[model samples]
Target: MTRTGSPAGVLSIKPFRRLWIALSLSSFGDWLSILALTALAGSLTKGSAENYAIGGVLVAKLLPALIFGPLAGAVADRFDRRITMVVADIMRFALFLSIPLVGRLDWLYIATFLIEVVTLFWIPAKEATVPNLVPKDQLERANQISLTSTYGSAPVAAATFSVLALISKVLFSQPQQQANLALYINAVTFLVSAATIFSLREIPKQRGKVSVPSILKQIVAGWKFVGSTPLVRGLTIGILGAFAAGGAVIGIAKVYVKQLGGGDAAYGVVFGMVFVGMAAGMFLAPRILQEFSRRRLFGLGIIGAGVALALIGIIPNLVIVALLTALCGAGAGIAWVIGYTLIGLEVEDSVRGRTWAFLQSLVRVVLLLVVASVPFIAGVVGNHRLHLPGKNIYRFDGPNAVLLIAAVVAVIVGLVAYRHMDDRRGIPLIRDFVAALRGEHYTLEESTREHGVFIALEGGEGAGKTTQARLLSIWLRDQGFDVVMTREPGSTKMGMRLRALLLDKESSGLSSRAETLLYAADRAQHVAEVIQPALRRGAIVVTDRYIDSSLAYQGSGRELKVGEIAEVNRWATNGLVPDLTIILDVPSDIGLTRFASPADRIESEPREFHERVRRGFRALADAEPHRYLVIDGTQSQPDITRKIHDRVRAILPDPVPPSAEDETSTMPAIRD
Candidate 1:
């Protein structure tokens, strides 16, 4: 399951290695600076004035994400992304170093705001670099490693901050001044982050002229693309929801903690709980994804957090509240990995930075809004205006009202997430195994055989087969056959990813033919992982096309010879072939006419090349007559389906119908 670049997986790139090291150093520096600032704030001001100032500084830090996330995103897309981070880090470095010299309250706010703005660019710049670093299959692991940095840093930093604050308190009368020196150390980290970015070397950028209109258009275009892609949209929204609630909970945590029992010491214990909980949550994420029923982890995280926070607010006991805080913390950590992993998987390289920035900005905005509402809510509860159903209305002195609110929202959101979304693993290990090995994932009902035969459609583009497969799958399901349906470059995780790259019109002329091996690699996983298993369990599996598509597209379309594709694919699956392949035959013109926009990467290939791919698929079908049934796709939908059903019935004899089943010409109030 771990896909780090090595003998087994593909994400370990040289540039990624350097970037990871740089990121670790940057994270360490970030921790050091934060501790320094917290200590300084603790000692600098005499009373409540200092807390307000500290809070103000914290608000300022969050502003960049709210105010300039889009602007930063635009810059990353239009210019060198690596340079963007370098510049952001450099900017922060200079500001932090200057902090000690200024030593005034005003300087603190200025430094905080500037550091935040720098973060706006830094986050997107680093996130955008991920896809280029490794193969899609390893993205989850890459994200895990990236996330582990924050999780790993938090616990260590908490301890470090406590120790450093103690030392500062002992050494200087003006302890804030002693902590002030730590800002210089933070500055050094920023410098190192910038230098490390500078060392990343050149990476390819999107090819085209960059203009104001183009940049704006590109940003809008990215959003449009997101809206249009259901997979992308569903996952993004789920992530956004979880992040928003997590933000509000974090905002209200202080009040919730103080009420529990500990005073100032409670801060470390609670934060430590969060760090530990989230790290543990993050660690569980991959396993849950691998083994559980499908659902988005991000949304799950949100719901988990929401429920946890609400419990903290309602639970009065400090120990339980601490545990709840940990739950909330863990949710936040898991959500980050899932959301970032989604972004890395879905977007293209050219606009990757902008897309990342857009998402960063989006989450930041959500966080900012949640944070801003905290004190206001506290005031309301304090004034006796706020109340929730079946629970006490928390007073505004602290975070209880807000924490309760977050918890309720989390449960609602978690339910929504579970009900709507499906799990998207990096690899659909179990389903793929079932499909490939011909086994039933769930218990097969005895009566299912009397209804429909499950069949999956698979094939290459321009093979004129998707419609045929769809028609066949429907006809089979409708003929009192219990049909479950799917297609390939697949409905599964590994398959969907390959499909995005393979059929993407915008990706034309970019992917290497040798890279067809990746497509084949995905298929091998699909087959050994998906197809045969379904067949073994009495599923009369009918596919539009299966391994045949890779053999055609990667083999002939990319010129990797059909046999080599077969061999590697064979190695991938031990030579598993589909029980039946219904290849929809088409003259190149008829097939070409089917694509109205011709906007996809693969579909836009030169005419002769497509013609050859068309020929290649036909030949593959012809070569495997026992498995492949060539059909005329130019026929009407009903006619095509009829032909497919005919082939299915010819191969798999129907099971005995129930006594009244055949006699029931009645509508039976059943909608198929």
Candidate 2:
């Protein structure tokens, strides 16, 4: 959720790094095998039989997932994940090595199917293991890195295959021999992956007895959970729709390219470009749309893909088609990464393996159906050309017509899925998108237990922040809420030292950047030790000050960039924005005069500087009016307290109704 930091932080975890490397190697090997097996299949047959042979190999590779996916997922959930992955990899290595040694078309199909079956088990285990290795908040960034490795390795694999092909041809002078060498190398990659996974001790093993009935029960439960949970159901449908669109594009691409008067080379370039766009979207969309809700972004990506696919059918220019294809790929990339991250964040660890397996199985089935059907559908549609006015020719083909239909379906899927899965409800999608484009920071309401309400009181010197915070804490406690009264820069034990350094007059000469960093250090510790833990325990936390103080005093008053300071604070707090911030508005001169004694370092600043600080608070409130409650600090203490109570009451859940006996027993008077 903290978009300010680089994704490199996820890689800093040694265990995740090891898994990432294994994933990359395995992915590279997978792509390489695709090329090698296809070529080998062609070589094993003659004339038109070669085409059938290649198609058979492809089908054999994909069909196992459809047949064995559920069982694979069950196996992953029932056993030690590290052992599951290692065993899967070892099986893959052995099967891959056997392919060339057997050297028969039938044997090739058997080996390919076996390898894919093992891969199905490895994938779910890997997906489930990732969330355990990284912190919950860092799941998005970790998913980003995993996805990049998953898809980004394709180009490298293609290049490696080409190099291997050249070397084999020059050394052995046999095309079949070259294909065999590539397979041998691909086999080695799986061995390396197995060795790597074996070294990872962090992947927890399933405890207690494992049985067929229990595994089946878990699988059934996983399916039921997916079907019953609206968010998960919506995510599943959206992911399938995205895959359907992609599968259609891939299945019909060869014919579509020819329809546009292009050859194999054009098809290759277009294919490569789509993945290039996908990599760009995965890596850059987070930074570009940093402020947008992840749920909205997922929906938008699906919509974007649908729109691009629709446009590709309408536009006749091949270059334009290429661009549209790239855009579609980019949208798919964003949706894919976000969807995976959401699963990790939302799903429980106990059922995570089975849930991921169900998703994986369904995805493979949908992809296979779309990939198998699209080509046939396009073939049936055929081609129709009409000569129009102004020497323009209009061509309607099977690919074009099928694409238009797929686009419509995809759009409908996106709209429905968006409505169901949007976590930030009531915020219009277009407004959120525009706000994100402008880089405005906002809070995303996660669908977690509504455990606590965080209210931050901000004001200049002598503006009664401490008094208001204390009053709110007491009122909340009286209403039967567990209240934690705290303050920034001095809340935790470590923060006490930081607070002294920040407030002491001797530290007045501290550099602006250093002062800013000191505040950030205190805030980081405060959030970790005080804020997050209390909130997790369902305690209402009322703090005297938070990030806004830095924004006001250091950012605006010191003339430093507010945006940079905001990013620093965002990183420090790991994107934990307060639910509500009450800004007690008071004139700088009057507020300063109310302080009867010597001022602290921040308070001792000039009146103009304090005025700038006041304006800073006002600007923030204006930007996010819903989150901020601006009150006149000059009002009576009772009046200010009543106003805050009203606003907070509207946000909090209604209190439980007391029983008649309890009501009769407790008729205590309200305190001033």
Candidate 3:
């Protein structure tokens, strides 16, 4: 949820990095196989039957998902994920190798079907295992990388297929032989994938009882959850619709290319461009659109893709078609990434596998129907010519007409999904979009802090923040304000231990990053256990030393990047920002002199460190004047107390009159 960091940060995890490598190799093979199989299918049939044969091959690849999708997730849930992935990869390698060796159309479909069945199990296991591989905060980044690897290799595969095709033409006597080289190479990639997966010991093994009924129950529960959750429902519909349009394009791409007077290479470029666009979109989306509502963005992405698809249907030039295909890919890619991220963030881990499986199953079924039917529809419509007055002829073909219809359907689905799941329904779409572009949008979920007020006192060590927080809470309580006074690093039970570890001089050897993480851990537990509950019940919660302490101390004082520190704390607190932050400004030497006891680990830092911390606090206040107050810490105690009281009064609830309090003296207090 933190928008302060890059998605590439997850790649630093070794296990995930290795898994990403394996996925890349496997995806390369899958893309190459698609090209080889479709080309071979076209070669084996005549003009009219070519479309059907290609559709049949594609259908064979998707059909297993309908039968094995839920079962695959169950298997992933009930078995060892590492073993499942390795076994699936090995089977796929054998099946792929057999495709080239058999040299029969029936064998081709059979092998493709078997490969897809293996893939069904592989995909769920991978998706389920990914959440366990990285920190919860890094899951989105991990998905971005994994998905990018999944499709980013398509361009490379297309180029490889083209090169292999030329090699076969020079090396063989028959057109059927042209695809053999690519298929054989594809088989090798799977073997490499299997080896990579087999070596990964990090993937957790599933434990506990498992059975057919349990699996079925889980599947049913997943579906029920999907239906009940508007976010999931919209994501499901949007993703399926997007893929349906994509499948239609894939089904007729070969024939469409032929109609444009293009050969296999042209088709390969067209295919490659789509994924190129996908990779670009996935890479750019998080960076550029982080401010937008993710739910709304998912729908908009689908709509954008549909518009691009419609343009593709109307455009005549192959170059233009390729460009539009890339644009379509970009929109779909954004939707795809956002959809998966939302699921991971919102769905419980216990049911995540089944949820993913249910969605995958539905998506595959939709793709199969669209892919199988679109090419046939194109063939039926064939080509038509209409004469105009000035010897001009307009041609309307099946591919064009089918694409146009699919585009319209996709657009409608996007609109419905957007409206159904829109979190910012009342906010104007254009206004929110413009704000997002300016990077000033409030991207957090609507705040539940309506009834309560949150205030934090932050400053360098020994700057009297604790004293000020105490005085302010006392003042608010005297005025009949429900005030909860707390301090981070010691507010809750868990935070107390962290506070001891952090402030003890004996722990001086702790690394700066470790110290920062410890503070964040304390703050997270404090917010969840102490602060949030008090705030929810309409209390004016006053906290001493919140997020700004970390940003100032670990970030600037320890010379760590402020943005990185902010990102960690933002996720830790679930984007909970205090309504007001008061910084008691004082010079480091003067502030340190106020401490009577032996200096703690942080307080004992050199003058330069504390100076940097002070500067950090001032900089933060300067940047957000509306949310911050900087008071001179050297002021008289009563003057400082009065200054804090004046600011606190602005956010406090209306004070109860003496007459009203006397009238309700015997009655039970009704709190919001």
Number of the predicted model whose lDDT against the real structure is largest: 3
lDDT of 2 by residue, 1-672 (tens): 101135447898999999999999999999778777866776676543444465567678778765675677678778898999999999999999998888888999988988888898888788788988999889989987887788888767766766676666677665456578889999999999999999999877863332222333444556775753445677788988888787677656645765697643355456666777787777799778866767667777898889999999888889999899889888888888778866664444556678886666566667777766765676577778879999988998887987897898788888877776664544566777887888875445543324667889998888999999999999998999888999977988899999999999988679999999999999999988888888887788899999999988887677665657877887788777788899998888889988767888988888877877787776566435557888889989998999899888876744443343367766543322
Query: What are the lDDT figures for the candidates, one per model?
Result: 0.61, 0.77, 0.81
Worst 10 residues of 3 by lDDT: 207-216
The reply for model 2, stretches above 4 Å from the true place, is 1-22, 35-58, 69-111, 118-148, 158-220, 227-230, 254-269, 314-319, 343-354, 390-396, 422-432, 440-672
- Tens-digit lDDT track for model 3 on 1-672? 201125558887999889998999988998998998998888778877888989999999877766676677689888898999999999999998998788999999998999998998888788887888899888988887787687678899988877787778799888788778888999999999999989889888974423223334545666875764455678788988998888898998887777787766777888888887887777797568656766787888899989998998887789999999888888888888888767764444556778886776566667888998987788788888879789987677988888887898889889988876565534578877887778756445536445678999998888899888888888788888888999978988888898899999999789999999999999999888888888888788999989999988886678675657777888888778888899998888899999888988888889878877787776566434446878888888897787777777776765553356568786544332
Regions of model 3 farther than 4 Å from truth: 1-20, 68-91, 120-148, 166-174, 194-219, 345-353, 388-390, 423-428, 431-435, 438-672
Q: Give one digit per residue, the lDDT tens place, for model 1 in 599-636.
A: 47666666666655665665454322335556666667
Question: What residue pairs are clashing in model 2?
Answer: none
Looking at candidate 1, what is the lDDT of residue 484? 48
lDDT of 2: 0.77
Arrange candidates, best lDDT first: 3, 2, 1
Candidate 2 lDDT at 498 equals: 93
User: Which scores better on TM-score, 1 or 2?
Assistant: 1
